[model samples]
Target: MDQKTILVAFGGASPEHEVSVITSHQAIAALQESNYSITPLYLTKNGRWLTGETLLDLKNFEDLKKLEDSCTPCTFGQNEFGQPVLLEQKTGFFSKPKTTPIFAVIDGFHGSKGENGAFQGACEMFNIPCTGSGVMGSAIGMDKVMAKTICRANEIPVAESVDFFEPDWVDHQSTLITKIESLEYPVIVKPVHLGSSIGVEVVMNQESLIRAVEAAFKYDDHLLVETVITPLMEINCSVLGSSRAQRTSVCERPIGKEELLSFQDKYLNDAEAKGMASADREIPAKIPDELTKAIQETSVKVFKLLSCSGLARLDFLVNEETHQFYFNEINTIPGSFSFYLWKESGISFTDLLLELIDIAVEDQNQKARRIQSYDTNLLSQKAVKGIKGLKSKK
Candidate 1:
């Protein structure tokens, strides 16, 4: 069999772009060249798509201007036969277009358009297999309010939250504040669709609540306000596999030095402290056996409920005083692909990457079995009466 070509796409138009870059580099390094060919696709902050040898080097990213100049910008679109093609400059005077079979796409994108299902929809249109959740799952998981709604429907324990649109908050400030005040103090205010703890504020008072809401609105049109769980211990578990079969990795207790896991504490500070050596975590979190089992089970349920495939990390906040656990959020495209957690389960990073690719191919094949089009053309049989005959006679 011919070696499958996998596109390790990263550095999307999201706040987590730099983190995605590091993730893609790690994946590219772990991929086995014998069974698959790796192509690095970089999505610039300005939304330009580029692919070239320069993207593979992590050092190139340090100098953004130079890296952008070195990479050849490209565009992706379907060809005459409905095959995906990449159009780029081949030479100084001539342009070259190439159409390579993308066996699978490993999405290292974290948030925004990339993680919010836009990229997934594009990949689906091109009939390319992609790792992680599909359109519905990605969109739902990215939006905190939507995820909470789904969890509530599924009887999953989630922190009580109130969602408000920016327009409503701006127009009816007093009403919104009254509604928010119904919940106790020390609430968490989050943007509807962001990750890496960006625009997440823990408000301990009414003044902070108002300020947090204002800050959150700047990041997204919708905001989620939830009562903070006192004496909170953050626990995270990685769930892997498709809807049919899934497994939960050993739980990790994330310890942060602040009131909440701030953006800097989660990524920037950790990166500066560890230099990619290891992420700060406590593997197999020090918790009771029953509590561990419950968290693991809930993690698997959330993964399947969200229709997520490939991999995802489910975060939870456990109240130390009450011993209550509440689902925090889900990361469809978790940082570093949650390789460390899987590694604890005896899966190497290289093996995990290969497994994800295999899952993507299998999922794509399964989807192909469904019938997408009808043999008859309904438009041809339609009349121009414009619902004249559709009126019901009472």
Candidate 2:
């Protein structure tokens, strides 16, 4: 039996570039002991797709320019048998290019085109099995406003807030501020399309809110300001499998130094390794069993509501005193694939990756089973004659 090649795709033109790299490395490490052959599909910060065995090492990333120079440029294309292949483009005029059959793709991206549905759409176009949410789900998951709106319409609890574009913030600062202030002071401001808390801030007054919004606009054109869950308790839970059949992992109460978990707190501090898995958290979240069950149930609901697949980590903000929780955001390609949560749920990292790959294969098979095209030639003589007068009539 031939070992299947899993393309672990990661990195992107995203603010969370480093975080994505860490995630890809962690996944590669886990898959090393497996029977599958791993191929590193590393997308550079400027958006070039490269692949090579060197990219599989975490240390090479210390100097990104050198690392990018070392890898081979590659892309997805079909082989002679119409099977998907990772085609490594030739570097020299006389050099023959190489091709590697891609069995499936493990999405290790965090933000931007990598996680915002673009990369997933590429995989769909190639008919390659891709792990994680589909195009629509990934796009919605990346946009904070869209996710909240969908959740609200589905009767899922979410915080009330106002969202605006950069032009609105610049042209009508006072008006936007008024709308945001309506959410009240000490609200949390976040970049609408970013993750890893890249441009998230908690503001106490109008002045600080203005400053935070100005700063966040640097990362994204759109911004969301919502009422902060004071006496905040951040609970996270991971969900696995496709929308049709999924299960939730154990909940985690991420312990942060401040009300909001800063990027440094989550990834930077003590992050010589262990991407998101490095974050301080109480696994199985010491909350009551009933609350945990409710959270788990809600997590699964939102997972299906967003049409998420493979795996996702849903974060919730709970009002500690009231014991009320509201959906915050969903990480479709969550850092480290949220395997830590699954670990607490009794699934090892290797098992989790294998399950995700299996789900992707199953999804692709299901799609293949459908009637994708008809046998009719629309431009045939009879069909052309039938439509000849239609255009003129219309």
TM-score per model over all chains: 0.91, 0.96
lDDT of each: 0.84, 0.92
Cα lDDT of model 2 by residue, 1-394, tens digit? 8899999999999999989989988999999999999999999888899999899889998898999888899999988999999999987899877989999999999899999999999999999999999999999999999999999999989998999999888799998888888888879899999999998998899989988988999999999999988889999999998956989999999988886888987997783788888888898898988889999999999999888999999999999988799999999999889999988888999999999999999999999999998897888998898898788798
After superposition, which runs of candidate 2 have C-alpha atoms over 4 Å from their true positions?
91-95, 382-394
* Candidate 1 lDDT over residue span 1-394, tens digit each: 7676788888877777887787778888888554888888889999988888888888889998899898887766666777665556465556456656667889999889989999999888877889999999999999888888889899998988789999999899888888887897878889989988888888878888888888888779999889889888899999999988999999988766774777666666644422122456688799998999999999999898888999999999999877799998999999889888898899998999889988988998898899988886444536424344566432
Clashing pairs in 2: none
**Reference-based TM-score, model 1:** 0.91
Residue 3's lDDT in candidate 2: 94
Worst 10 residues of 1 by lDDT: 270-279
RMSD of 2: 1.8
lDDT of 1: 0.84
RMSD, one per candidate, in order:
3.5, 1.8
